[model samples]
Target chain A: AQRVTQPEKLLSVFKGAPVELKCNYSYSGSPELFWYVQYSRQRLQLLLRHISRESIKGFTADLNKGETSFHLKKPFAQEEDSAMYYCALSLTGGGNKLTFGTGTQLKVEL
Target chain B: DVKVTQSSRYLVKRTGEKVFLECVQDMDHENMFWYRQDPGLGLRLIYFSYDVKMKEKGDIPEGYSVSREKKERFSLILESASTNQTSMYLCASSSPIRPARGGYTFGSGTRLTVV
Candidate 1:
């Protein structure tokens, strides 16, 4: 079974401060990891995927196979960055079903 | 751009009433999914379909059912709505033909409240 765990429910940070949302997964095979973001009054959207290796909105996540972690990080938090972030995992040949974490509510205070 | 659209933005229903949540996608993708979002639980997959008339039970399929009679449409059905079922419902679509690197396209979501 594939499971994703996001330890933090709420993360508060001052503007310009670095932000990191932790995520860990349990899967026997190589996994595809993604970070989905839901901004205020907006639909949930894909922020970044591990396979893309491209940063969107200054957010990046590196998949660590050894630790089975894919933590989302940003160099500096902005007020506009406040939103709900969910970490998801998908296993190859697993029908592309996404197993999502509990999610982290990020609040960037100005 | 791919667009996945949920039929409703909000819905209020009484307990025990039959409820239906509809989703449509214009990208002609082969896959469609239904998920429910709760405050701390994130998005829980309720059901998904890979082809017309083909459905798969997701992680939390209890108290819910789905139909995919058409290639572009999927509908989630709640035989008896319950308070515990009140939450934001999201729909998404993706194509396996594309590189797995391309993530899903999601709908705006429908906020359902069962009283």
Candidate 2:
């Protein structure tokens, strides 16, 4: 079975501190990984995808196939960065169904 | 700009009552999905449609049904609403025409409550 796992349920960090949200997956074939963020009173939106390899909002995630991980990281955490982050994996076959992790709540305090 | 809209921002329905949650997208995307977002569980797919009148069962579709009469509209129906079904329902759309970009545009979402 395909699954995505986010180790932390809540991650608190002071402003300007580095942040890392760990994500791991289990799949036999290649998978497409994504990071989605949902802020307070806001809709869930796509933050970034491993395919593009582009950084969004100062955050970057690298897909390590050998490690079966796609960890999201930021050099300096900002107050505005606080939100519920979900790590998702998309199966390349059959419409690319997405299986999301439980999610990690990042609280960046001043 | 691509936009997906759900019919209601919040809905309260009694258990055993039938419920309908409508979603429309103006992007004319070929794929539309209905998912329920829950705390600590993330989003779970309930149903999806690839084209008009075509539907597919997702990971969790036991008590749910869907309709896609038109290209831009998709509807989720709960034959008998249960307290367990109360959740944040989200609608999303993506252009299957472009397989390179795995991006999905989501709606604001509807908070459904069962009494």
Over 4 Å off, model 1 = B100-102
Highest TM-score: which candidate?
2
lDDT of 1 by residue, B1-91 (tens): 5389899999999999999999999988889999999888888999999999999999899999999999999999999999999999999
Docking class of 2: medium
For residues B1-115, write the lDDT of model 2, one tens digit per residue.
5399999999999999999999999987888999999998899999998899999999999999999999999999999999999999999888765443357888999999999
Error of 1 at A27 (Å): 0.9
Candidate 1 lDDT by residue in tens digits, A9-96: 9999999999999999999898899999989988888898998899999999999999999999999999999999999998887778
> What TM-score goes with each of the models?
0.96, 0.97
Candidate 1: the clashing residue pairs are none
